[model samples]
Target chain A: MKARVTVSLKPGVLDPQGRAILHALEGLGFSGVTDVRVGKLIELELAEGTPLETVEEMGRRLLANTVIENFRVEPA
Target chain B: MKSGVVVFPGSNCDRDLMVALELVTGTRPVALWHAEAEVPAGLDLIALPGGFSHGDYLRSGAIAARAPVMRAVADHAGRGGLVLGICNGFQVLTEAGLLPGALMRNAGLDFICRDVALEVVTTDSAFTRGYRPGETITVPVAHHDGNFQADAETLDRLEQQGQVAFRYAGEVNGSARRIAGILNDRRNVLGLMPHPERCVEEAHGNLDGRRLFAGLVSVLA
Candidate 1:
């Protein structure tokens, strides 16, 4: 089994990289793009039937900085 | 002062910080590797030097924060011992939950590297005791992720408590309130983006950063 963690800057936290990407899209003539938020996707190989709590713990401890980022785990 | 400098695998400034510590304290600091589960005993200060620690893989300082040595670092701070985290060290401190807020990518999407003016926000902490409040000094910063952000209420508390130790004389990284440095609520731990260790000698064209080391050494040693 594998666990995939999606980490993103918490809402209302400034995402400058996302904003820059958005600006580049607009410059490239992409229209109607209201927003862009950049984040990370981390995949981990875990034993089959591993509990979500364990992966969540990874996010809480390392994968995401809870102060300004949020992370969610999904089965991969 | 009996100081120690934590050397993470990718830490490049450990030598610089160690040199500054030795020059100011008249003794070399212990070079504790990140793998060590314990810091040297009887250390007055533990300096986390700047670098691309753990290669800034998951996030700046993320992996390094979880290294075994940080367990010792956290213990040191909880005992009221002084800890100074510079640049990537700041990121590690925040990631380790020893400090509030996070340093994000630069707002302009550029790697900023240059001298910038900073104002001392408070002189009460062990880290800023050498400077008068509101005095400005120049220090060089080289980083990609130095933008500091936190919720509004946390910012208010830090300000009210004078935990904000330094702020940019002018905007440099789009940091909230232009914060260049901050002290932990205990006022013993400090984290900042600027490389004070780089500018600690007159040969570096400035003695402003020297005062910080000198003051801490005298008081804490």
Candidate 2:
């Protein structure tokens, strides 16, 4: 089994990298680009029948910092 | 004071911290590897030197925080042993849950490396007792993710408790309340993003950073 963790800065936490990307898009004449938020996708290859709770535990423990970021686990 | 500097694979400032400790305390600090499950007994202080631990992967200090040795460090802190984490070490402490808040990317989206002015917020901890409150000192801060962020309530609690040790005199990083250093609730653990060890010697251009080590020795030794 494989799992994917999507980690993103929580709303209201400033994202400077994302803001820089947004400015770059505007500079390139890309209109209607209201916002850009950068995040990370971590793919894990786990043994079959690995519990979803275990993956969530991984997120809570290491995959994301709950203080400033949130993570969602996706099964593939 | 007897001290130890935890050395992770990517920790580049371990030697500097050891040197600073030796110079101030007049005793060599033990170099504890991150894989070790237990810190040596009878250590008065455990210093986490600044560096790109675990290559800053996943998140800053995220991997190193879960390292085997951190359990021992936490136990040490739990026993009221002093802990000082500088720069990357600060990030590690927060990730380890020994301290509060998180270090985020600098608002400018650039790696800042230079001497910045910092105001000592409180002289209440073993770490900052050498300086008077409101004293401005120059220290070098070299980091990309030095911006500090926390929820409103935590910030207020820190202020009310005098947990904030140092604050940037000017806008150096986009840290909440311009916090440069903060002490744990017990006041024995301090995590700060500036390189105090780097400025401990006169050859380093100024001795402003030396007082932190000197103060620790006075209190803990």
Candidate 3:
């Protein structure tokens, strides 16, 4: 089984890297790019039949810092 | 005074902390490897030094926070033992849930390395007892992800409870409330982004950082 975790900074949390990317895009004459946010996508290989809850636990414990980031797990 | 310095594989400031502890406490600190499941008994202080632990992969200090030895460190902290995390150490503490808030990338998106002025926010904790309240001290801060952030309620509680130990005098990092150092609720654990160990001696061109270690030793000894 394959699992994917997408981690992103919480709303209202400042994402400096994302902001820098936005500025760079603007400098390159890209318009209508109103905002930017950076995030992480982590893919995991797990044993068959592994529960989604277990993968969520992994996200809670390590993949995402609940203080500043939120994570979504997609198991495939 | 007895002390131990936790040595994660990428921890570059372990020796610096050991030297500072030895100079201030008059005792060599034990180097506790991250793999060790337990800290030696009878240790008074455990210091976590700064570096890109685990190559800052995934996140800074994220991997090191789950090191086998952290369980023992938490137990020690639970017993009211003193724990000090500096810079990346601060990141580790937050990741370990020993402290509140998380350090994020600097708002400028640049690695800042310079001596910055900090105000002693509170002297109520064992870590900041040596400094006068509101005194401005100069300390070196070298980090990319030193900007601290938390929800408004947590920030308010930290202020109301006097858990805020130090704050930057000016805009140093885009830290919430300009926090430079903060103490845990029990006041035994402190996590700060500044490198006090780097400027504890006259040779370092600043003695302001010496008071933190000396004050801690005085209180514990």
Candidate 4:
């Protein structure tokens, strides 16, 4: 089994990398970009029958820092 | 006071910290590896030095924070033993749950490395007791992920409880409330972005950083 975890900064937390990308896009003549945020995608290989709860636990423990980031786990 | 400095594989400041600890405390510090499950007994201080630990993979300090040695460090911190994490060490402390909040990328997206001015916000912690509260001094900060952030209520509580030990004298990194160093709620663990070891000697330019180490040894001894 494979699970993917997407970690993102909590709303209202500053994302300088995302903001820089927005500015760079504007510099490239793009328009109407309301906002930009950057995040991480983690791929995990789990044993068969592993529950989403287990992957979510991994996210809570080491994959995402709950203080400033939120994570969602998707199964494959 | 007997001190031990943890050496993660990628840590480059362990020797600097060991030297500073020896100079200030007049006792050689034990160098503990990241894989060690327990810190040496009778250790008064456990030092986490700076560098891109575990190559800053996944997230800054995320990998090294889960190292086997951290379990023992956590136990020590739980027992009221002093733990000091500097720069990258600060990131590890937050990731390891020894401290609150997170150090995000610098607001300017630049790897800032220099001697930045800092104000001693509170002298209540074991680490900052050598300095007078509100005094201004300069220390070296070399990090891209030193921009500290936390929820508003936590920030307020840190302020109200005197956990904020140091604040940038000027806007160096866009930290919340311009915090440069903070003490854990237990007041035994301290995480800060400055390198007090780099300037403990006169050759490093100023003695401003020496007092921090000296003060800790004095108070803990």
User: What TM-score against the true fold does each predicted structure earn?
Assistant: 0.98, 0.99, 0.99, 0.98
Candidate 2 chain B weakest lDDT stretch, 10 residues: B197-206
Candidate 3 i-RMS (Å)?
0.5
Model 4 per-residue lDDT tens digits across residues A24-58: 99999999997999999999988899999999999
- Judge the docking of candidate 2 as incorrect, acceptable, medium or high: high
Off by over 4 Å in 2: none
Distance from true location, Cα of B129 in model 1, Å? 0.9
Task: Please report how far candidate 4 places residue B30 from its true position, in Å.
Answer: 0.6
What's the lDDT for residue B6 in model 2? 95
**Candidate 3 lDDT tens digits, A1-76:** 9999999999999999999999999999999998999999999999999999999999999999999999999975
* Candidate 1 to truth, TM: 0.98
Candidate 1 pairs with clashing backbones: none
What is each predicted model's overall lDDT from 0 to 1? 0.91, 0.94, 0.94, 0.93
Task: Identify the candidate with maximal DockQ.
Answer: 2
lDDT (Cα, tens digit) per residue for candidate 3, span B5-82? 999989999999999889888899999999999888999999999998999988999999999999999999999999
Per-residue error at B159 for model 4, in Å?
0.3
Q: Which prediction has more favorable DockQ, 1 or 3?
A: 3
The per-residue C-alpha lDDT of model 1 at residue B82 equals: 94
> Looking at candidate 3, what is the lDDT of residue A70?
94
For model 1 chain B, where is the 10-residue window of minimal lDDT? B212-221
Q: Candidate 3 or 4, higher TM-score? A: 3
Interface RMSD of each: 0.7, 0.5, 0.5, 0.6
